[model samples]
Target: MSTLNKVADVVPELLIGAAVDVVVRGSDSFIGDVLGVESRYAQLGWLAAINVVVWIIESASEYAAGVLWRGLAQGIEHDLRVEAYDHAQHLDLGWHETRPQGTTLATLNDDVNQLERLLDVGFPAILQTVLNVVLVGAVFAVASWQLTLYAFLPIPLIVIGSLVFQRRLEPLYDDVRERVADLSGALSANLSGIATIKSFTAEDRERDRIAGFSIAYRQANLTAIRSSAAFVPLVRMAILAGFTCTLLLGGWQTLDGDLELGLYSVLVFMTQRLLWPLTDVAEVLDLYQRGRASTVRILALLAVPVAVPAGTARLDKPVGGRVELRGVRAGYADGPDVLHGIDMVIPAGETHAIVGSTGAGKSSLLRLVLRFDDPRSGEVLLDGTDVRELDWDSLRGSVGYVAQDIYLFSGSIADNIAYGRPDASQADIEAAAEAAAIADFVASLPEGYGTWVGERGVTLSGGQRQRIALARALLRDPALLVLDEATSAVDNETEAAIQSSLRRAGERCTTLVVAHRLSTVRHPHRIWVLDAGRVIEAGTHDELVAQRGSYAALWAVQTGEATA
Candidate 1:
């Protein structure tokens, strides 16, 4: 009904404009008799004035409808694009890892844009056209039913032709959309990997590949365009046929005296005015199908089931971060187990270190503990509670994990450090920086903590990024701290300072370190060695060196007694 009212506002003006032509035709037919009197000429001139006013109203209505529709379309586009991006971020890590960045990019940017085009232009015009058609047809009916019915005889043929083209074009546009995403993905990958492409001297190869993708996209569009291009012309022909029928049938009817002369003028004008614009309905239907296809792809992303349902557990309520691994037998999908039937316990206030070689699954172990990926079997217990059973927010909140591959976001140093906990005070942030041994570097900078790090902290050195990451993790003050080579990139001097901070942190919280560098663990309460996903040995550093096992072998290699 609301839609109907908008149509009512739009249609009357279009009808009036179309009716002006009818009025002119009628006045011309009666001109010989009317012009015979000065008073009749004056009356005819006044009707012409009314027709001019109606034409202006019609133009104004179309302009208003276009403006209103465009504004609404922009709003809708903004909301949908933002919503899709936000939902994509909330999805699980596997989704990002598995999905093509280019495909997702195309869905968010290109597909959303397609919707905007349809809503702004195609949709508004469709409504206005419908209003025009209905109103003009209604006018013809009122003027003379005999002529009105006869004039629209070929309209059904035009409509049928439109539907046939619509059915054929829908699937073609779907193919075009897929090809566009493919081309977008290929282009995005090439751009992002330009350095790799150059290093491997694969630039020519990549260009050829992108050319193939673009050609496919073009071909898909051409296929649809081939069909869509024919439709408007075909529809126009059908309309021409209808107009011819109206000219012949209405002319004959008037000659036979079955129709009044004035109404014949209305029928002649209304036949073309009412049905001719419908030739463009083919183009409009094409836009609609394309928009709908793009929408389905976009909403599919939006509607991906919430993989990780949110939990409301608080960070402050863990049981002193008492950490335990109870028979955790875990592995990746279809892969051999990385952690086998492991049982370990760390009292609430002790520091433990796990040392292993490359692929010793040290990092994988941290991933399991952090609940980034769950253990295939068994549980990671926190304060006698399985971490999985705990709310994700609460579990990760109480556990501060600083990974080996440090990533510092591009932002102010203060913002990067406070990424997790926003309300951390200035002093607290400084203390964290001091503990991580990057305080001097930060203080020496012109902006202090206000310095902006370039993308992924490219502005900072590797060691500086590491320290900043450590500082960021330190601000969390979690119950359990897992630092995987937390001081690996730092200089010896910085290492000592971080050690001092870790020594102090030792008394405050349980620390788990995964390191190959024995120098960092001279004072750890215990050191566990893992090989082939099983713990090979466990003891103090002195005890492990004395035992001459896997741990001693690693210790000897680090101390220069053995290389393997």
Candidate 2:
């Protein structure tokens, strides 16, 4: 369609030239001689009819091209953005931990928009410019190949200059892309931490920090723009040279009776049409370079190997929630092992708690079991099957996990509770909320289950968010229920209620709890005490207290029985 539009666009110039020919030569004009329409008035009328048809074709083709290009741009933008986000979501936690959220977001949003801009306008403009040159040059060649030589003399220089500009602008635009990502990252971090910024009275500091990023981004753009701006003037000079040669040489031929006056006029108008668009090369190159840079980033993100690859094995129905870690050594990228060759097991339907201080690898153990990261050595097994060999849906679907830092989506309380089980009945949602001890609070709200939680449940208290998250997990009715500091945010009363709920829940499923507070894990079937990536003690709470090991020491400190 764009090709058709470009071809149609060149017809009017030919018609104008033919009109001149008819006026100058009458019966000798090519259309008059060939079709035997010798009357000059009739030739003019024929030219007018052809002009209308050409305009209609041009208009229709332009409209079609616009719709097709814009549609293609939109489809590509949507698919690429979704693909990048989907791939990012599946990447291992360790991979995500090393990169900034803002940078990733910039790639997904800003970079994709750049590609859209190129497709929507830049690509069509480039295609039309190339076609105009070829189509007009063909006309010039047929009428006067001698003048064509002069008309196209500067094209090589324009092409060479464009290439040089494209190469120079590539690195500059790449720098611009990086700067934008930095700006996005800083802005995103500041917005998400706006409350912290206010509480710390660091608004000015954050503003200045973002200003710094913005300034860097502006500088990068200016550098690319300065280089890109130089391209047009140089192209214009080349175009001027080409146009001048054609005007002088073609006019000389016409005066010398070696070229037809009509053909000379055609050459003049077509020269401008062809070389003038070359001046727009700068803008097109600017878009192309930016889009190219964005494409590189997008492809790089898409190419990142999934650190935790899914397996082909599916968990059988009636999953036994037996979990075991055998000689498991795990850590983040380039970090010392957080869990060092630890061996442990929780039989199906047993309730176990892992109590450890910060950096003791308690949460790290959970990550391994959940298959967020593969063990550096040995295996994390579920029901005697290595977890790395289990399909993602089967593995994750079977285990319900509530993290230490609770996150609730922007939606109703019921929506959040039923997040893991979206099809869960209202009775089930309410029951799960009731089990997490948040039912009374929901009922107190004017909207009840439909009450909005706001962004990340900002309208709710820490305990409320935690309970809502726990309810979301319980709604899944998972075979293995893992809680990492799940009750840390709650009050003593709420904690007691949640513990009571856990006792009942443990009766039906394998439960693994990680907690800093010794009281939360005291009543579990067994407790494992970790210190420096090693399981230092494991036994019933009373048995550990009787042994007076690391668990006893921490228990003493937490209970205020001793000063630590």
What's the lDDT for all of these models? 0.79, 0.92
Which candidate has the highest lDDT of all? 2
Tell me the TM-score of model 2: 0.99
The TM-score of predicted model 1 comes to: 0.85
Measured on C-alpha atoms, candidate 2 has an lDDT of 0.92
What's the distance in Å from true for residue 244, model 2? 0.9
Ten residues in a row with the worst lDDT in model 2?
Answer: 27-36
C-alpha RMSD of each candidate structure in angstroms = 4.1, 1.0
For each candidate, what TM-score against the reference?
Answer: 0.85, 0.99
Give per-residue CA lDDT, model 2, range 1-564, as digits (tens).
Answer: 999999998888888888999999988997797668989999989889989999999999999999999999999999999999999999999888889999999999999999999999899998898898899989999988887888898889988888988889999999999999999999988888899999999998888889999999999999999999998888888889989999998999899999988888888999999889888889999999999999999999999999899998987889989999999999889888888889999999999999888889999999999999999999999989999999988899999899998889999998999889889999999999999999999999999999988888999999999999999999999999999999999999999999999889888899999999998988888898899999989999999999988889999999999999
lDDT of 1 at 83: 97
lDDT of 1 by residue, 237-330 (tens): 7788878888898888879988755666667767877777787787788788889889989989988976545555444464487788888787
